[model samples]
Target chain A: MTASSALPYQRLHVELDARRYPIHVGPGLLDDPDMLVPYLAGQQVMIVTSETVAPLYLERLKHALSGDGRDVREIVLPDGEHTKTLASVERIWDALLAAGFNRRCTLVALGGGVIGDMAGFAAACYQRGVAFVQVPTTLLSQVDSSVGGKTGVNHPRGKNMLGAFWQPRAVVIDTRTLTTLPARELSAGLAEVIKYGLIQDVDFIAWLEARMSALRALDADALTDAILRSCAIKAEIVAADETEQGQRALLNLGHTFGHAIESHQGYGNWLHGEAVGAGMLMAAALSQRLGWLEPDEVLRVEALIAHAGLPVTAPASMSGDDFLSIMRLDKKNIDARLRLVLLSRLGDACIHDATPSDMLDALLTDFPRR
Target chain B: MTASSALPYQRLHVELDARRYPIHVGPGLLDDPDMLVPYLAGQQVMIVTSETVAPLYLERLKHALSGDGRDVREIVLPDGEHTKTLASVERIWDALLAAGFNRRCTLVALGGGVIGDMAGFAAACYQRGVAFVQVPTTLLSQVDSSVGGKTGVNHPRGKNMLGAFWQPRAVVIDTRTLTTLPARELSAGLAEVIKYGLIQDVDFIAWLEARMSALRALDADALTDAILRSCAIKAEIVAADETEQGQRALLNLGHTFGHAIESHQGYGNWLHGEAVGAGMLMAAALSQRLGWLEPDEVLRVEALIAHAGLPVTAPASMSGDDFLSIMRLDKKNIDARLRLVLLSRLGDACIHDATPSDMLDALLTDFPRR
Candidate 1:
């Protein structure tokens, strides 16, 4: 499939004050190496990928990167969220040094969010920083993580506990990789897909309801359309608040609760998207309880998440108190104050300062048995 | 030793393209916390200092940091070149995440070069990249490491083999700290002092010879003046080539051969400054052998380094063949070609493409019976 043959897609630009980059979306786009040529002006290239995705796509990327007379090299890391650690980062640094990579080299991230984060970080530190390209493979990364340029590894105490907000030269998403994704992993990707609709686009939420079946079936047109729209919405929000200073906080609608669930459950016990699926349902319920959202709206969001094969309730082992304690350590918290992004309506949200009692009561109602 | 009572020192700035920063040198500078106020506008503050320096100065800094109602935290790592490693970085990330540090935070490196590099690397990774300040405690850091904004930990395979070129918001050099430095460490600092003279400051070299007695006696005024000048030359070179692009290569006059000597001798076997001291003499001999420098010029530089009580000869353990093999792994090499910075005259140097045979002969003659 060739990029030129695919349907035209919208281009969303993230305007960082000095370092600006564009996010391009469409079908069959990965095959077009010309789009990446402008950023690869240098001769040295280092591709960072993971074990699961490397064997499938690294060679193709190497060939595409070699188009501009650049010397191509690659470092393959272990797959899964567990690989996001200082130990893993050390491996990347060793590889770069062993290869004699300098500040002039370009680092290409060729896997999912973990690969993108770690690779982007390696580029950020290699000679202070080098150019980086994001080639997101997973659906979760394509819609969210790949767009913002937030890169780093996780600590045992929290998710994304350590990281930086360094932007990429360009982001390349190849929907072709989605064809090989397992059904369970594909369903996990829908969590972030649903997040975009719930935050700032009601019309898009309704659109997802109509096409959710097609997306789950991996229909090419439906999946591509969903991805392009998600990227466009994200690009707009990120451009306005690249560093998460203002409206960018809206993007974390369910992340505060989502991170708590992930942290309490022990990171890999549940995939990040799965936790977010359950977290969004909790946020909607809390919004209804707070009189900010209608009860019917809460039901609608929960139904969509359940229909998409995502968990709509907190993990059975986690008590209401456990969730509360974990959320306190969230990055959004200021001086131990718990700040949550709660829904005011399907397309509108606000960052609310929630009291400990209010949060405890809401949690008990959601996790009634506890 | 209040800043208000001291004579005003001239300021020199390092122009890093879009990100320019100033190098502040004077007595009692650290006591004036207002100097750090501009860079501390972020949400969280993590100060990376060493055990040796922390007990002596951390409280004074902590008091100053908390003045603006910002949340300031400190993490103290073991002191030494050996402490700069991946394991140490992991400890830093763990401490950062445990303290709830995020992208909006600024890491203040409060020790010598090792602390600055390790902390700077942590800041670079903690959330992709965050702002950091360099408060160099030792002369080596004040004159060399802190100014470049190059941050990273050492890999098991090599020194500074893993890191980034992330710049600092500001560099604070308090000459008062040098009063606490051990005589051995003070002499180690002189290694870099002689470096500026060997590279591109003949007049500075002549200046150093005239005041070697005062400097050896740790005269505060003379020491601060030398530090400011060394930084000025480095800032100019770094500004012209922030990433060692062109003339910045001159900074590595002794580094290539220095790194080989350090690696072969076992890192920590010789202080980095000590190896560079000897390495500078070897590079001078190699330059003379290549006819790029006169014999008299080599003797002058060698005499200055020896006068500072620094070793001017390589260790007996490092063989000529081993030195050549190790230097090839340096990032400065281009496609198996070894590049070395050679002095053309006092205060001027140029990078040359030296062949394996010429390099081997220089090493053999320079380190006979090795």
Candidate 2:
């Protein structure tokens, strides 16, 4: 019990000049209008969420967003990562036009990463861009996806191949929502939370290791602390590089290989964070091979990922060639060069595009498979 | 021949802070790599054109774009206004990813408005946006779409219902391409060129009246002069209001009513500029009813549209109610009020959200149907 018990919420800002926005982490934030209404671009508010999330939180959010002047509407899309497509976003744009929503309309994304990414992309292109608020529900979104403003849908050839770097007006994260999240989803989110520790904060990694059990058990303080720290690390890095021109690529610590898994398995087959969990292990192993990370460091990464209930190895069906083929299309690669973010040590990461192909082939071929 | 024959090209810049770019109006620019290569973001270039224009200019443009270390690929889409959909943009994204084009790649839009719009939008979202240049061949594109950076596709619900305000790196308008254009398209292009005059340039309107015949007959000097003046005016307005927030809406003087006609008739059935031509006459007539214009002024507008060989009346299939319903959902409308960009006087326009429903009803009902 600390001041968090009395305050009940923690707030942080992503410093992006005129586009800067706040991320609020707490319990029971879904029912609070104060955290949302101020950031809306205008009176037209459209809440976009998935079928899985609407029943759990829609009415409460609608009530919170309701006002004398505001016009509130919602579209309940089918659930799952497979639904993250241009067609779903088209449905949003169609509804907006049908409802006569205009340039001043604000989109409120009220689900997990799939919902947030799709809703944010819809807002980015709607009327040549409008305002949107992210009311992210799931641990993965609360910690990572909801903060960076990386919004888009996956293509058949790749995951998140089509997207825009459109920032949100605000992010409202409710720890209470995690209470209803499936155990697998909660663990999936922990992968990204652990990623923050592995990439930039060694101390935070130790902190997460000690408190992983408490977080899994739905301990409010632990969840709030974890989300706040993860978002702060993200906000800092994003502030330094808003468009992924430089340091921002470091945040994709395991995403290149992770995206390959997601794209190959079909988007909805594997959870994003789950794919990233195994990807982080692969990155650590490769770093050790490069003499940048110790063998013991790789083991610690695997152990933490395992403790988080995330996959520690690649899918068995995917061969080295499949991974290489899919990874070749990762958005991070420039001018035909494959770039990977690898751990130089426990607390730091570097983007290396000069890895020896034979060494990469050996790692992909010999790496443990589940 | 004037000074035009001496230089062969005229240069103007759209001042958008750091995003400022040039608009080059000339004949035979397709074979001049010097006009394009300087703006290329990298060695990778994807040329997106329509099938109709590919046979005419694709190889010539490719020859010019070809150079040491440059990688150029082309995707020629099926042509037409109806083909403007997310599906087309997806195909563009598919080809770019297939080629492993990176963030540094540049997309060259090598056709009319439809091609420029789709290519520009694909560039806006590919790998979270890459650089793109406008190689607009049609007169309408050279003078309007290529200059303003209003890139998008029409939705089933409305025209240009999906898009982004992604500016191009440069606009290369080759007057010679107009030689291959159909007579109807040349007239359609004139409708937009006429719009610039009616909206902001009284002198240009007078100049156009004197030389409409020369423009229609493809007098190179007259065409070049018309394109330069139109682009210069559009660039000034766009620079002042990049997004259609305030003064920019003035640019849509006939567009609100024009879009209604396009939507009602289906996009491809009516050329955008033809619908706008008839729509502009409707606007002038409505202005007369409001006591803003003389009856002679209305006739003058009608004659100009007729002189351009554009439709001067609404589609026969559309009823006033049909127009009203579609106009209700126009992006410019706010709070259920229908906003119309009406001529306050010749060469000037205003966005009137308070148009009495009865007056609009009368105009829609009394306006002649073709």
Candidate 3:
């Protein structure tokens, strides 16, 4: 159960009965078709990827999958949050049916969080739910989006506004795919890595703080260890609460505030990890205001976010009322009442049904207009 | 249990843990707000109806639900098979979001199969999945679509080619709603009513043959009894095999051939139930040709379809090749193999892995060129 002992390898199973699947985390896991082929279910495979990742790793992945009897097809979507729309989802469906993908076929999502979410949503609806595999190529996807069964496309009105919580048959994380990722993207992925620590893993957070430099330097050992730990934590949480009824809300530590920023700033304006970083800072500041955390503890959270090269403050143009309005529409809100997943302390979080007035007041003070 | 004593007034449950819900069938169930309130889960309810049903029953259902102290909203879609599309689905999503419907809201589909499918798909994708209730107003929906939890909009390329199997919290089938149904629409619904009998209910077929006249006349008792019996059978099948692995495919008895005819003649050109009516004859003929069914049995199916005022023959315009190509893309087809559910006898069905060449030959003979 210890991080080191569990490192360098471990398989976490998501027990959804017949739909049960495993998340394999380690170096070079993606190259092994044996890890994925068992779940293929049929001969036809469609690997949904992005323009950016196509040139780098799509060919290798395609080669590996098509090496045997598998008839692999690839559809490259435009890279970015902009492509997560109804139009894009329709295109994926068209390509899938065009390729004669029957209900037995599998859809393989081969990129970051956007690809996984969009592809998974497409799979969930294509012929009323087909099996899908998550070959998450980004650190953020590998650690978070890939582990959770949540998949969806963004609507013009909201991010991830249209989707399903369809768990993938398997998630293949090849840490080597990160070699070509941009520095900013890598840092954004670390934001989620840092979140696991801030929300429920004090020991892991301590370890992350110690290995921050090594991770930034793209040390294979550091990256793999972080991913393994993140997936394990997420797997445990999701297994307990498949849907966000109770404890699963804890995983949305920064997401309520983060979604507001994402929607207000326009999706793709801030990388999800960046918005989450700033959102976590806001949560920490609010926790400090409520006397749940020491002011110094709030500073530590902000410092870690800043050190990871993520935004620690809200965007300048967002007003308190604007943030509150956007957050109120968040799916987490019940009966129009805003619910925030606030940390009681580092490594411990609770869902707070904060009054709108209190939330707005806290947001106003923490992110005051200049 | 005897048919009348078999819980004539009881609720049938589709057990899926937290997602489990009941299907209440009987006279006067629609006015009971208590039956619908528990599933609402929130104060905001959006009732998706059609131009046809809105003028008749929307207000009554709204009033019934209003007793629970919740805000009720209704979106009236154009009344027809043509309205089941991405465009209409987007409108439903837009209306829900515009009216401030968050994840906590419930969508009540208060029309026939088209509205139920489109509205259900909209709910499935709305914030990754929300609760929906089926208030199927047509004979087709009451007996079939409303009970099984299969929901989706149709694509221009195919009927129900785009959808999700998102279960509803409950189904409210008001047999009174069929009182205003046109003679043609009523007969169209009978196509499905006959389907249950063809696949696995010889006794139901005999009952329908004996009572077809009274049911067509919209006799209150006969219609309600038939709807309840069909729904009970569908509920049991769906409960055992939610995803159509084996037994569920039996329910698609005439759908494969019916979908081809509908797609070939153009989506709205043929009433879905009409096409299925004719398609069932072709499947029966093919079953007889394959020595699985007797010629007399095929004649019996054809006679019942004709008695129900449905076409038991293919239209002159469609070609065998066109029908073959369309059936090839059916979701049920595994790999390039065309797997169809064909009747071996009156009360049993088997998944036949028919060769494409043989099926094409059968199509050519059944729908000979002009």
Candidate 4:
């Protein structure tokens, strides 16, 4: 084992009734059976990963999950945000049924957010829900998507239009996996880590500003700390609102605008985190217009996003009308009101369904484009 | 409105803590706006029905759910068990998104088991679940699938393999709809009605034996009583075990073999209740071999199923091997052990995972065929 592999892990729990699970973050959790095995529902284990991740870590994950006389299987799906669909989830279900995996089977999702969402969704609907564990191999999933039980696939009409609130039995985040993540992807993940600070932790924003360089350099401590703090904040919010009925919508601070970009640009083009980074800036700008954030706070948000190597501007091709069209279809919206998570202040986010169309149009039309 | 429209509805609650819902049974309940509107989650109501039932009742249901300025919409899917698919469910999600239905929007399932299961499964996963109500138009759904939250579509390899346990806001069973149901479907529905008696209540079995003619003839009073009793039994069981941990398996008394038959026969060829009818008899015969039921008891089970006009024999084309292969894939099995619910006695069912291979083989090999 490498010297980095011996780093001690930190564990956090998402305190959900009956569905409570642990989030284990460290340098080499992928190789630790003790971290993954106890969470398995039964003898059956299905490791659902993407083609991009299989060669890199699938075997080691299987190795860690092996030797318990378990029936271990793997399904390598094509990777990318566009591939997040019911058809992809069906393939996972098909593989499990083909393998004769039952309700007691556990699905271990071993890739980034797309893989985690699709595999976790498959586990949710497979035989009316089975236990699943998240072995997120990307920084984005490790810090954000993997921590929550939100599992679903995107629809042609909107992102995450089809899914379930299926919590994982455990979340295993091995910081070593980040070393294999491309710099752009790591930056995408940093967007969500930044989101935690922007939404609920102002001090975390300062902490991130200090450590952005180290995080970009793949410093183990910096990345691990970011993941732990981000998860802790998310775990608390998700525990309060497991179904996104209320406070949990705060997590989608930039997601309303981000999803529109993703949907309009077509999934995978901008990457969810990249779009979210830009969307967060748009939200901050809107918050400024609403007097919720100072002009300096908006600049701080932009500086942080740019420093993290994320996009600071919306896609040039998207029009104000385009944003409204796609944003109208957002799942967060209830009835005729379009709900967007905005900053009431730094370190505090609020769901706003009463945004005036003219103000939103001005922001979308006036927002800087790439 | 018909005189039967004045029939007082009986309400039964499936006590599932926060997810608990009521099942209302009576004739002409569909035309009563009071029955459906109160259960809807919001002003946006999406009515999911089949082409077969749309011409007959959609207008009335819409009228009842309208006038309150509710944006009630409808999607008429092609009817049949073959159409019970993720693709069909995607169409539902697509329609919901197309209509801009939000998280609080309600999906009203307005057909038989196939429609109820598909729409409920759609609601279970649409934006991670929305409120839904069951407006069951057929007997099978009214007494069974609509009461419990076991909603899903069948896979090519298995029946109801992909789904979730999402309870409905209410179940509105209008006995008047059964007046237009085909004679064959009425028999199919009776199979499940008979199952409730066979699994847990011998007195109900005797009561059914006396009332079978009345039920088959569509006697409103007899039908309502059967519906109420069946739903009460299902509600009690589902309340105790919402996710089918232990006692819920008793409800699947004939479903293991039934699903095998359905899968082998190709879904939609034999109605789900028809397959269950024959499968229940098979379970009885197997129970006799296991010395749990006397030969006369097996005959009584056969007589009841046959009297209900359901098949008393397995399909002529299927072999012992076909049944074995399919039954081996039953979801109730765990860790390579095949679990089947068999009769412990009249009105009492037991889950058996230890039936001797030779005995199961002999029963399968010697079982009567059409």
Candidate 3 structure lDDT = 0.83
In model 4, chain B matches the true chain B with a TM-score of 0.97
Candidate 1 per-residue C-alpha lDDT over A241-281 given as tens digits, one digit per residue, 9 for 90 to 100: 87777888888888887887888777777788888888888
What is candidate 3's TM-score against the reference?
0.93
Q: Which residue runs does candidate 4 get wrong by more than 4 Å?
A: A1-7, A316-319, A356-358, B1-7, B265-269, B316-319
Of the candidates numbered 3 and 4, which has the greater DockQ value? Answer: 4
Candidate 4 per-residue lDDT over residues A246-272, each given as its tens digit: 998899989989988988897788889
Q: Write the per-residue lDDT of candidate 2 for residues B6-81, one digit (tens) a residue.
A: 5468899999998999998888887887888889999999999999999999998898888877999999999998
How many steric clashes does model 3 contain?
1
Model 3 residue B17 lDDT score: 66
| TM-score, cand. 4 vs. native | 0.95
TM-score of chain A of each: 0.94, 0.96, 0.94, 0.97
For candidate 4, lDDT tens digit of each residue in B239-348?
A: 99888899998999889889889888887789888999999999999999988899988998899898999999999999999999988877788878899999999999
Candidate 3: Cα lDDT at A142: 91
TM-scores for every predicted model: 0.85, 0.92, 0.93, 0.95
Candidate 1, residue A295: how far the Cα is off, in Å = 5.3
Could you give candidate 2's per-residue lDDT for residues A181-224 as a string of tens digits? 99999999999999999999999989988999999999999999
Reference A-B contact fraction recovered by candidate 3: 0.85
User: Which candidate has the top score in DockQ?
Assistant: 4
